[model samples]
Target: MIATPVSSPAYLEYGLDTLFGRITKRAECRIGLEQVENDAFCFAIRVPSPLSDDLEQAKTLVLRVEGRRLQGTVRHSERLEDDSLRLEVEPD
Candidate 1:
């Protein structure tokens, strides 16, 4: 789906910590126009960091917007919560 900005420059980006001790910087990962129903949205973010041979494995992370923030997990590897629909993505 990969939602994109329409009227303005508003979108969501996710940063991941990879298994190579490298931090994945923030980048726009819009699921699609149809996916974003309101100011609030939930998306499955994959933290590339692993439990083995990786930096910290990125067990817990944060999701922030305009000041409001929430905590996310990589316990099962990038599984988005049920509050919002999951966006279709290419196979990793």
Candidate 2:
């Protein structure tokens, strides 16, 4: 598959099941280009610091962009000097 950069606004959502129903944390983010190397693929996105802890803990999240939903796992994350969190995701 050819990976392309997503220019639309993306949202990340992770949910938890509770007695009250499934509560979800959602944050707006920017979806980077999907990269492929040596037959392996990787995806990435950037979210604000406010959601960093949640995303890191959740590990897996649904990325919604341009009407498409991609389920991915966080492979790695790093905090930028500007405080945004850059996450490396492997789409499943």
Question: Please, what is the TM-score per model?
Answer: 0.27, 0.61
lDDT of 1 at 28: 34
| Candidate 1 local distance difference test against the native | 0.34
Once model 1 is optimally superposed onto the true structure by TM-score, how far is the C-alpha of residue 14 displaced, in angstroms? 5.0
Predicted candidate 1 versus true structure: per-residue lDDT over 10-79, tens digit per residue: 2333335656863643333222232323324433333221212321344444444333344444333323
Tens-digit lDDT string for candidate 2 (1-92): 34445444787787545568756788786655455445367766656545545565556678877777887776777777877666677788
Quote the RMSD, in angstroms, for model 1.
Answer: 11.0
User: Best candidate, lDDT-wise?
Assistant: 2
Worst 10 residues of 2 by lDDT: 31-40
How good is model 1 by TM-score?
Answer: 0.27
- lDDT by candidate, in order shown: 0.34, 0.65
